[model samples]
Target: MALAALLAAPAAHAISGVLDTVVIMQDVTDSYKWPREQLEWNRVVAQLQEQVHTTERLVQRADRMIELMGTAENAADFSAPPSVMTPVNQAVRLETTKHAIESSRNLFRLGSKTRSTYNPANEVKATFEVAGATETRDENRYAHFAMQEAMYARYRTAATHEEEVQGAETALQEETLRRLKQVKTEAQIAVLTASLAASKQRQDLAHQKTVQAKADLDAFRAQLTTEEARKQEADREWSETVVKRMRDKALTAYRRQFRAVGSESN
Candidate 1:
C-alpha cells in the first residue's frame, strides 16, 4: 500500500504540473486587448527608432557619395542628367538630391540658426545672464500672477470653498470668544465649530488635488529635460563621433591592405 501511494504521488505531481502548463497556455490564448495594445505600442516605438537610424545612415552615406561623385573616377554632369549617365552615376545623383531634400527638411524643422556644440562655460554664462536680467524678474512676477489667476479661474469651486473655510474659521474664533463673554447659546457655538470642520475638510480635499497636479507637472518636466539630454547625447554619438571612428577604421584597413598588396607584388 505504501509503494502504491508513493507511485500515485509522483503521478499526481506530474499531472498537476501538466495542468498548470495547460492553464497558463489557455490564459495566454484567452488574453486580449491589453497585451495587443502593449505590443502595438512597442512596435510603434521600434519603428520610430528604426526610422531615425535609417535617416542617419542615409545622411552619412549621401555625404560620402557626394564626395565620391566629385572625384575624377566618378565624375559626371549631375546637373545635365540627359548627358549620358551610367546607372551608378544616376543613382549617385538621385541619392545626392535626396540628401538635399533631407537637408532642407532639417533646416526648416530645426530653424536656420545653426546650433553651436554644447559648451558648459557658455551655458553657465547664459544662465547667469538670464538670472540677472530685469526681464527675467518681470517675467517671474507676471508668471506668478497669471498662474494664480488661472488657478482661481479654473478651480472656482475650490476657491469658493477655501473662502468659506476662512470665513468659518474667523467666525468660529471671534464668535466663540464673544459667546464665552456674553454667556451665549452653546448650540450656536457648536454649529459654528461644525461649519469650520466641514469647510476645513473641503479645503483639504482641494489642496490635495492641487498638490497632486503640481507634482505631476513637475515630474513631467523633469522627464522631458532628462529625455532631451539623452537625445542630444545619442545624436552626437551616432552622427559625429561614431561615424568618424568608423571612417578612420575603414581608412586604416584600406591602408593595411594596400601595403600588403604592394609587398606581395614586390
Candidate 2:
C-alpha cells in the first residue's frame, strides 16, 4: 500500500503539471490572439483613414473643378463689345474648358470607384495561369473602365479644343483691333476730303463774286466815257456860232464909215 501510494502521488503530480502547462499555453494563446485582434482592428482603422484622405482629396479636386467651371461660365458673358468673332471665339473657349473639367470629374469618380470592383488576384492571376483566359468578369465593370478611359480621352481633346479656341480668340481680337484702326483711318480720310471739298466750293464762290463785281465796274466806266464825248461835241458847236456872229458885225461898221466920207467929198 505504501509503494502504491507513492506511485499514485507521482502520477497525480504529473497530471497536475500537465494540466497547468495546458492552462499556461491557453493563456498565452489568448494573449497573442488579443494583440492580433487589436492589430487587425488598428490596420483596418488605418486603411479607412487612408480611404478617407483619398476621398477628401477627391472632394477638393471636385470643388476646384466646380470653381473652374464657374469661372469659365462667368467669362463667357463678357464677350460682346468688340466684334462678333470675339464673342463666338470666347464662347467656344469657355465651353471647351467646361467640358474638360467635367471630363476630369468623371474620370476621377470612375477611378475612385474602381478600387472596389477590380481584383487583381482573382482576374489577373487567373488570366496569367489560364490558356484560354476569356474575360468572365462583369461587363458593367469593363464598361465602366472603358467609359472612364473615354472620359480621360475626351478631357484631353477638350483641353486641346480649349487651347485652339483661345488661340482663335486672340487672333480674332487682333483682327478686330486692326479693323477698328482701319475704320478710324477711313473716317479721318473722309472728313479731310469733305473739308477740302468745302474749301474748294468756297474758293469757287469767291472767284465768281469777284468776276461779277469786275463786270459791273467795267460797265460804269464805259458809260462815263460816252457822256464825256457828247459834252465835247456840244462845246465845239457853240464856239463856231459865236465866232460867225462877231465877224459879220465888224464888216457892216467899216462899210458905213466909207460911204459917209464919199458924200462929204461930193
Task: Tell me, by lDDT, which candidate is best.
Answer: 2
Report the number of clashing residue pairs per model. Answer: 0, 0
In model 1, how large is the Cα lDDT of residue 142? 32
Q: Write the per-residue lDDT of candidate 2 for residues 115-199, one digit (tens) a residue.
A: 2345655332112324766544344434433434434444444444444444554554454454445432333434434444443
lDDT of 1 by residue, 153-204 (tens): 2344334434444454445445445544542334444444554455345445
Give each model's whole-structure lDDT: 0.47, 0.48
Give per-model TM-scores. 0.31, 0.26
Return the lDDT, model 1, position 151: 31
RMSD, every candidate, angstroms: 44.4, 46.4
RMSD of 2: 46.4
Score candidate 2 by lDDT: 0.48
Q: Which sections of candidate 2 miss by over 4 Å?
A: 1-191, 259-266
